[model samples]
Target: MTDHPNSIHQFKVKLINGTEKKLSDYKGKVILIVNTATGCGFAPQLKELETLKNLFKDQDFEVLAFPSNDFGRQEPLNGVDIEEYCAVNHGVSFPMFDKVMVRGSEAHPLYHFLTKISTPRWNFHKYLVNKEGEVEDYFFPFTKPLSSKIKKKIQKLL
Candidate 1:
């Protein structure tokens, strides 16, 4: 539980396509890390996430989705299936990691850090991190991805 900004880099996560990625690769960017679910009430946020990504393409903002079934068994698809569902249904183009548990002892390292710093109340919960990899803010699942609150935060960080 180091408060070091680069501590996130020590964690590696698998991509939906079975590739491994290091958080260090996204060091100099503003990241919105979210725990997602395909059948959740906020599932449509995937589209909003895509919209945000496109709008902030020139800026240092990115959305990293981590599909999870930890809440209500919402997302049951594996990596490959989830990837296809997102791409085909929501036209999601942002990076999506492999399925992960966002809570409890088995949670991924990245999520463990996130929840430890700012606990996510439920699915679709978001952690906004600054360019230096510091946790800046936390948004609940009910908050729309493109809401003014989130948009303003992104603008301020950029």
Candidate 2:
């Protein structure tokens, strides 16, 4: 790892299977990190996120999804159930992390870093990180993954 303490790569997160992973492993890649809720109205966005992943997976673009129950108790399932739901319903194939608290005092360190850059008002909020692991942009829960605005940003990063 590098000595850059301000980088997103410095954070660690847990995968859906409970495997701890260093964000440093994704250094130099453009990452779209999103907080998802399987039971939320925006759950359908998972499919579009998967589309983006399939379209840019070979271009150093990665989508990392983290389930969160901090909003309206939208994500009620445990890690395994959440993973299975995404895979079976949305065909999600990107890296999915364990359920995390995206806001409040108990929020994960990674989310703390993310919120410092852009506080999420609700579930399905997204943070677009550049190749340098810096927060480049923030998308509200209502922003569609296929929107020209998001697509253009992803294109520029890729």
Candidate 3:
């Protein structure tokens, strides 16, 4: 996928490890961006998200999990602790970014842009971005990462 002169790539985010990265780095990849909460009832979906990452990563798919506490204080872990917990409990291997506000004026810039289309109504809300850096779909909190609908969309994107 060719990079557009101006696109989602212009936004940057901090990684779970405190490093900064521009979304442009993922240019040409199908990105599944999820706002996650470790203590939410939907937390178990993290495991399934990892599965989705493992299954399609080789095909240019990337799962970008952004821990958020904006919803009911569900994700209270600091970056390091969040990383450890996810690795030990769910065996998560996908990129986990630093805790971010998923709504309101303080939200991350990427999220601000995303919310303009469809704000996350709850934890685990997902935004699927195509290789061209355009949002193609929005999956609600209860939508399983591996659900047939999501898989079909992914397959079509691939």
Clashes of each: 0, 0, 0
Candidate 2, 11-85: lDDT as tens digits:
888999999999989988998999999999999999999998888878999999999999999999997899999
Ranking by TM-score: 2, 3, 1
lDDT of 1 by residue, 1-158 (tens): 35543456567889998798988899888989999998888999999999999999899889999999999999988878887898899999999999998889998888878787777667899988888888889998889999999999998998
List candidate 3 stretches off by more than 4 Å. Answer: 1-6
**Order of candidate numbers by lDDT, starting with the best:** 2, 3, 1
Candidate 2 regions exceeding 4 Å error are: 1-4
Compute the lDDT for candidate 2: 0.91
Model 3 C-alpha lDDT versus the unseen true structure: 0.89
lDDT of 3 at 16: 94
Q: lDDT per residue, candidate 3, 11-62, as tens digits?
A: 8889999999889899899999999988999999989999999999789999
Candidate 3 lDDT at 96 equals: 93
TM per candidate comes to 0.94, 0.95, 0.94
